[model samples]
Target: MLSPAGDDILIIMERLGPVQKKILLLFHGIAAIGLSYNPRQQIWILKQIGREWNKINQQALNRAIKSLYESKLIDIKESIDGATKITITQSGKTKSIEFKIDEMNIKKPKI
Candidate 1:
């Protein structure tokens, strides 16, 4: 059960879970590269990214994808090449920037 404002807040948050944030951040990294999608490659990126950064596993991968899609953070569709393509939406991109900018602002140690 949720109130009107609560539902509105959820709409703004897109109901993005923590795992969904990680997933969006991964797509954000890729979007930074100007190649938003690789029909040739797939969630291999997610698995590799999780392993590199957080040791997130396959179930997490699946759930993250599910959440992101449900939240409208990412779009999944077929490319002209007949492969699946996935990309972060503007909403996802903006949120990812918010997520990572703080990461970049961490104070450095004095030499």
Candidate 2:
């Protein structure tokens, strides 16, 4: 049996699971890379990292972009082609670095 406080803790823990953290990292990373490119362009660079790691598809890509944009990790501008371009925010850069550090820490083997 779980107390109310325990249930709240469980809910918070469930929200920050491995998969959610990875998705957040990937979305920020992608936004960072996009910001390094032409912002006015109709197309954004779609790297193979997500496919390599998780077999990403169109819907997943859309979801990630939407999530990041809503979180203000990236800014979106519509192009003449009616397509959206992404630019990473300053906060996104900081988050990206933090994510990289977290990845390095996780990948490091126990001594």
Candidate 3:
């Protein structure tokens, strides 16, 4: 059972912008890659995704990350070495799955 605050966060997550959605999916992909190979090798540093995307500008990516963080979708942590790590929360995983399902299509056959 989710609290009212959690529900509110979920609503905010559902209304994420295109850049935010892409970031969520990127985090999802990183998790999937971890499971597929060595989990330890799947860490994503902050700004790395933006650099790899090569399309979304840095400011936009930063804004999306901040939004996602506020929505409680992703957790950002900084180590003593000052390396920032981004990990998707369970809520984020659910949202990413929703995005994938929303993109899936089934074609009907005309007999």
TM-score per candidate, chains pooled: 0.57, 0.48, 0.68
Between candidates 2 and 3, which one is better according to TM-score?
3
Candidate 2 residue lDDT tens string, 1-76 = 7567546434433434344345556666565665766653413334444443465555766776676676665688
Query: By TM-score, how accurate is candidate 2?
Result: 0.48
lDDT of 1 by residue, 1-111 (tens): 657754653474656666677777766655544463665354565555656556567798788887778777789999788998888887767677666532667678999
In model 2, state the lDDT of residue 94.
52
- Candidate 2 residue 76 C-alpha distance from true site, Å: 0.7
RMSD of each: 7.7, 8.7, 5.6
The Cα RMSD in angstroms, rounded to one decimal, for candidate 2 relative to the true structure is 8.7
Could you tell me the lDDT of residue 111 within candidate 2? 100
Give residue 5's error in model 3 in angstroms.
9.3
Better of 1 and 2 by lDDT: 1
By lDDT: ranked, best first: 3, 1, 2
Better TM-score candidate (1, 3): 3
Task: Name model 2 segments beyond 4 Å from true.
Answer: 1-54, 101-103, 106-111
Please tell me which model should have the higher TM-score, number 1 or number 2: 1
In terms of lDDT, model 2 sits at 0.57
